[model samples]
Target: MRYIISYVSTVNPNISNSDMTALMDYVRLNNNAIGLMGILIYSEGNFFQILEGEEQTVKMMFEKIRKDYRHHNIIKMLDKEIISSSFSESRSSFTVISDHYNQSELHQFLKKEEEHNPEHYKSISYLAQKFMKFN
Candidate 1:
């Protein structure tokens, strides 16, 4: 079965731009090899990510991500089986919202998401829509 997991974490303030770029590159390569698709968004000092793939594979990845030292306060917002991946065309996509304009836009989009459907897959779709808009 397909599964999707969405979580938010506080990013380490000390990590530099180059470090973040390298980290995303590593994630893309590894996720592509493992048949995962997702989008990772970093805004200010927070990270919001949604990962979709085979059930067991996604679970194992989440375990490793939970232990990674680059972030803290990892709170899962959604975890459930899904009909399909919202990002099937890409291995992984990332967006770093550095400007105030895009950050505000993303914040509004997330707030709207909360008022929409509560289904896991739908939430993932909404997140992908917003991610594509900003990135």
Candidate 2:
């Protein structure tokens, strides 16, 4: 089984970029032990990312995030049991470009997707397009 979780945490005002980089290095090195698929950290309007493997791996990674001096208040915005991961291909971990944040649209689409796939975890990307723009 797989899970998808999107979370946010407050960055510690005192932490520096170099410290963050070192912390991320530890996370990258110990990923497999924790069941991480991918991690994306948002700071100063920029999102940093790491992708690992497994549910336990991801959970362990999140635990480290909670204790990191760089982050303060942590909150998980999304979590779900996934039938399959969108990231099975590619390296065990990688970080790169991130897309723009379109919050209202994303939330609205997720709501509708949950409604449509109440029993199964189905993709609602197209349905979101059909309904969200009209409303």
**What are the lDDT scores of the predictions, listed in order?**
0.69, 0.50
Q: For candidate 1, what is the lDDT?
A: 0.69
Residue range with the least summed lDDT across 10 consecutive positions in model 2: 94-103
Please, what is the TM-score per model? 0.67, 0.54
What's the CA error at residue 17 for candidate 2, in Å?
2.9
The C-alpha RMSD of each candidate to the native structure, in angstroms, is 6.1, 8.3
Residues 9-105, candidate 1, lDDT per residue (tens digit)?
8878888888887876687678777877665676666777877888999999999999988989999988999875555343243333333334564
| Residue 135 shift from truth in candidate 1, angstroms | 13
> In model 1, what are the clashing residue pairs, if there are any?
none
Worst 10 residues of 1 by lDDT: 91-100
User: Residue 69 lDDT in model 1?
Assistant: 87
